[model samples]
Target: MLRLLTRFIGLLLLAGGFIALIVDGTRSIAGGRLLVTTLNKGASEFFPALYQGLQNGVSEKSAFLWDPVFTTLLLLPISVAFGGLGALLIVLSHKQETTPRYWRR
Candidate 1:
């Protein structure tokens, strides 16, 4: 029973870890790069408009515009971090056997 429970828990953890690793890897590779490109273009195009908008908002004093793009961009870092941590946990939980000498140099 204990063995079964352990295996069940391990399988769940393994699956979660695999997901996190994929998310982080994808963010770090594709998502992060895309964000960098998007931000570069957005900033270049919008700096003047952004400054004027900020000035107007400051005068209004209680309104703000949140960008979903920023949030998504932020997630790329968090996903990568969580994924790395999950991968580490999965790796640490593995019960590795001693490598056979025949398989070693």
Candidate 2:
């Protein structure tokens, strides 16, 4: 029962993580739409300011690039680990045995 629970949790997290990535990837497209809307409203300065700040940010002190790299690297191993664990669980799941249960002949 504990094994089943653990497997369930692991699979759940694995699937959830994948779903989050897909949803989060849509942010780029959504952001483009937001930018267009903002520019149309004449609130155009904020976006360029944000972009310049990102560009001028200190690489080591700020999260502009390094953060994404670090986050990506961190998530990559976790994703791979979970996937492998799920696969191992599937491969190791019990199968019908060759040995027969004791009973009347």
Candidate 3:
């Protein structure tokens, strides 16, 4: 059940990543330069208040964590972040085979 849920969520995120990639590609073509939306920019645009609050909370908890770790993550291209996460989740959700090896048989 949990695996199913994880896979479903991963599929959704993968779709979102694909859409973001398409949008970025179109923007880049139109602008005559490479354009990519960062995770921070996308999150802020989608949920400004939530993003701001989260940023503030992280900064307050530990400036080092926020400045280095989170800043680097948030600076990644939105498509890369979403696609990477989705792929990881999908891979993690995969079931292992239980069949015995031929040598054991």
Q: Pick the candidate with the highest lDDT.
A: 3
lDDT of each: 0.51, 0.51, 0.93
Runs in model 1 deviating more than 4 A are: 32-105
Give the poorly placed runs of model 2, Cα more than 4 Å off: 28-81, 96-105
Q: How would you order the candidates by TM-score, starting with the best?
A: 3, 2, 1
Candidate 1 vs candidate 3: which has greater lDDT? 3
**Candidate 1 pairs with clashing backbones:** none
Q: For residues 1-105, write the lDDT of model 2, one tens digit per residue.
A: 766776676677667546544544565477764221121122224466764554456464776665666345434433344456666665555465787778823
Report per-prediction Cα RMSD to one decimal.
Answer: 13.0, 12.5, 1.9
The estimated TM-scores of all candidates read 0.32, 0.33, 0.92
How does candidate 3 score on lDDT? 0.93
Candidates 2 and 3 compared: the better one by TM-score is 3
Best by TM-score: 3
1-105 per-residue lDDT for model 1 (tens digits) = 654555556566556555655654676687556332233343445586885575466546644333443335433433343445555555666666777677575
Q: Which of the two candidates, 2 or 3, achieves a greater lDDT against the reference?
A: 3
Model 2 / residue 9 / CA error / Å: 2.4
Mind sharing the TM-score for model 3?
0.92
